[model samples]
Target: MKYILGIDGGGSKTTAILADETGKILGKGRGGASNYQTIGLENAGQAIKFAAAAAVEQAAENLSVSWADLEGSVAVVAGLAGADRPQDRERLRAALLAQMPVNPIGLRVEHDALVALAAATGNKPGIILIAGTGSIAFGIDRNGRQVRAGGWGPILGDEGSGYFIGRAALTAVLWEYDGRGKPTSLTKRITSYLQVTQPDEIVPLVYQGPLQRPEIARLAEIVLEEAAGGDEVSCRIIADAADHLVKLISAVLSRLDWCEPGIPAAGTGGLLQPENMLWTNIAKALAGTHPQVVFAPPMLPPELGAVLLGREMLDTAVGQEEFIANLRWSIEETSQS
Candidate 1:
């Protein structure tokens, strides 16, 4: 049987999946961050190889296919960070080819957001809000035109994202320490999480170069914890984040698509992952402002969406039953092993 691979290479992590012609996932794998911008060519190549090999290995274990016995393989539709620049994309493409000798027709790449949209709702024309280390909203109109808002990265935009919330927490800490802003629990929570007894230590520790996004974003979780514990300032921070994201979602729905009555909107990224409670607040905020917005369960990993796109382009029709079965299997496999 022919096999295709899809990879979603994000800033913090990489996900790879193996799927058959019917879009049924056979196996899946994950690896560390493969964002070419953060890790460079050598490390990025290694990460991608690690992710792809794991997926292939799992699939081979189930199907009894040696590396030589595979009929076809493809890695088209990688939505990787830093892929916006032509040179960066080229560099990653070259490195990917060097790492894996699959057929030239089998490889492809795109921005991580594009693949996320594809995976979120089968790329059928709707908006997706992604809130992880960064935030972005994109949508396809009924006419197939695409429009995007935000996603300018943490420094410029990414409001309502984990990075944004975390940065806000740090700013609050600074403000409170200097007696310039409202007192907040963030100062204590953040300093404590970093294992520092005093807020003064944060300035030097976080600024010593090599700031980790996930570590910083963990502060956002602390902010949430504080909110849950009834800290008014923390509650306000979470509320503001919800408002910011709701605005972005509304804009995408209106500007990108016809402000139609119903659009197949879905939430994605780490913030919207099922276990994250932030999505509940976001959904509540949206409901108050507009008509009921539909929330979709993420049916496939972004890598699988990339592979599905390739499969559709190549005239492979994955039936609904097969698709659902693969999705369930993939989720179960990940949860169990």
Candidate 2:
């Protein structure tokens, strides 16, 4: 009863999935933030360990197997946020190995964006644009060349991300409050969302307290709500976000040698919510210039992408069309049941 473990360690949370050799999902677990760059290495390591252990334990109970037995038979692929550099990947891999009980047969750690790409494209050469707490555009060419744009984190980059939209909303509110900009509903919406009577209090709450990146990112929802309610400023912010994301995609495409009309692209992350104005605007914007581009829904969640990649580490044949289809079916069935 060999198993593979897929871990998606993002800024907001860590998710682990346990699956059998045939790619049938066995169990799943979730834990706290595992972005080693944002959270400390120790905290990130603990989150991974907690998620993996919980998944393994759940699988063991269901299979009537022991934890020790499961550990020995596992292979791991982790798609971790903040593992942007080779050294970051190595350090986090070392930390995970030291912290977890599993001595997996094989292990690979990659940037979370790569996993999103894998999930969206089924390991094919395509682009993945993710806009959650942070934003990044990652692509792999048919030649196996990989390029990325805008993953510098919240402080330096993260354009088109939830954080970007939220920060823009905050600034818009402050500008309106100071009579520096046209008054907008964002001032009232943002203040209400923060549960503060005045917009000035948001500055102190952000600077002096537990308001973290994800919390700030969540504010983008308020902006979306206001935009839907016909606020001009909010609509402009959403449009700007879409434009930034389109730039990211265009940047990646420019670096690639392929000029085929139908290059595949996929979107992921909270900011790309299909029902949101941001997502709608992005779709419309892309269709105008990149009409030849084919946009598809993701084939698998990012965690399952880790699983598929882990299996590929052992045997590339696991990525065959039939195998992937079966795997996708199993995952879908599990989700429904």
Candidate 3:
């Protein structure tokens, strides 16, 4: 039987799923960071290989088939971070193929944001605002036109991302420590979170220690928690994050000519949680400006969206109501198990 593999390769982790032609999920696997730009090409390739092999092995086990039997018929679709340029995509594709256990029918690689957008709208024309460890806004119009804004990574952009918020919190803490800014709870909270006795210690920990991007990004949780507790500085940070995200969405919308009423838009990533002030403020801001916009929740995670795209590549139709329902059930079951 023919099989398909879908991969979501990100800065924090890599996820791979194995599914049949009809969109029935069979197995899932996860591994460490795969953003080639952050981790280097060899490391990213290893992560993708590790995750894909695990998924394929698990599917072979479940179906009582030999691994070799499952290999030749599989179609691979990967949505990888840091694959923005055609050369980057080609390099990553070659690296991933080199690590595969068996030759597959075909392989396709795309930027991670495209898959996030696909997952948000099920390949329909809509906008997706993703604010995880990094942030980007991508949209596709009815005419198959695509536009994007603000995925320049931490050093260049990622304005509303976890890294952005965390770096801001750290800056605020440092300012407060030096008496240049008002004393805020973040000064205490950040020092404690970093296990440093004094705020100045953060300098060495960030610069000399093994502090990675995701580690710094994790500090955004502390900012959120403090904001929830009514810390003024933390609240302002989150509000600023919301404003940045709104601007990203608005820019994409303008590029897509989607300023009219009833354009479907959705959000994905850590900051877009409905329970958080970040998301609430973003929703309010967007509504005030674009009242007719329909803000929908994501229909599927990016990994599953990769699978959907893989199916499409195989000339198979997915995203029908029943198929989506089954896919959702399969995802929940796999996640729980």
The per-residue C-alpha lDDT of model 2 at residue 57 equals 76
Q: Which window of 10 residues has the lowest lDDT sum in candidate 2?
A: 313-322
Candidate 3 lDDT over residue span 1-337, tens digit each: 6778899999889999988877788888899999999899999989998898788778877875445876678889999989998999999989888888888889999999888888778777898899998999998988888899999988899998999999999999999989887778998888887889998999998899966778888889999989999999999999999999999988988888555688888988986787588988888998899786787678898788888777666655645565667778888987787
Q: List per-prediction Cα lDDT, in the order shown.
A: 0.74, 0.86, 0.86
lDDT per residue as tens, model 1, 208-302: 84446677776787887888788777787788887888888888877764765677777887666553557778877776776647766556655
Backbone clash pairs for candidate 2 read none
Give the per-residue lDDT of model 2 (tens digit) for 1-337.
6778899999879999888777778778899999999799999999998998888777777775556776678889999999999999999989888877757888899999999898888888899999988899999999999999999988889998999999999999999988987889999877887889988898888899766778989999999999999999999999999999999998998998788788888888887877589888888888998886776667777778898787775544444576578678877876786
Question: Clashes per prediction?
Answer: 3, 0, 0
Candidate 3: where is the Cα deviation over 4 Å? 315-319
Residue runs of model 2 more than 4 Å from their true location after superposition: 315-319
Error of 1 at 330 (Å): 3.8
- The best-first sequence of candidates by TM-score reads 3, 2, 1
lDDT of 3 at 65: 48
- Model 1, residue pairs in steric clash: 76-108, 79-111, 79-112
